[model samples]
Target: MKRLIPLFALCIGLPAAAQTPQLILESLVAKAGPASAARGEQLYRAKSKAGKTADSCAACHTDNPKAVGQHVKTFKAIDPLAPVAQKDRFTDPAKVEKWFKRNCQEVLDRPCTPQEKADFTAYMISVK
Candidate 1:
């Protein structure tokens, strides 16, 4: 029982964002069984249905996870998506979900499934 107190305190002491990646991944795994980094890589590079007007993740992010990206239309600079390259990349659940929703719609013309999110997250996490 004494150990539980410290564990609880540790959980409570961390910011919500600090636990965002693990919590999001856990929930995704619960729904999807497991994420596939390979599938994620494929999805990330797949062209969107929007065709000429659409932008795949790689269109902006480039093929290398460690390299910086650039927005296709806006030409705005984007930070690397890899957690290793950017420590804060997946630290905010809200931000992560927000981008997922927006990007999925923009690229896939639909919302991504929990599996897709998990796969993508797994791929990003796998990057060194």
Candidate 2:
């Protein structure tokens, strides 16, 4: 019975922890309604008004999300954002929300709306 408890717990938790990119995007759309890939692309490339220096998702991610990127400040190598290039790009809902929270604050001076997040996810998924 003790061994069964742990195994059962793991089984129950597995599906919640493991999610597909489409699943995550669908959840976001549930909150924000339909997402527009074109709007997402525009937002990703738009310059920020958050600071004097130009800061946009494209500053680090580049115009092509399918290509690997380098952080402009840290110079850390970032994997491609497109799910087509990186199958794990948006697989984890927690990580997806984490990056959106951090990056939106950095680039937009505010956390992104559910609509914005859904749009971004749609755009990244569209890249092949």
Candidate 1 worst ten-residue window by lDDT: 1-10
Candidate 1 TM-score over all chains jointly: 0.81
**Stretches of candidate 2 above 4 Å error?**
1-16, 51-54
Residue 32 in candidate 1, Cα distance off native in Å: 2.0
Candidate 2, after superposition: displacement of residue 126 in Å?
A: 0.6
Expressed as tens digits, the lDDT of each residue in 17-92 for candidate 1 is 3544556566566667688999999999987767344568898889998899998888899999888998888877
Q: Which candidate is the best by TM-score?
A: 2
Candidate 1 residue runs with Cα over 4 Å from true position = 1-17
lDDT for predicted candidate 1 compared with the true structure: 0.78
Error of 1 at 9 (Å): 12
lDDT of 2 by residue, 41-101 (tens): 9989999889333399988888899898988878989999999998888888779988998
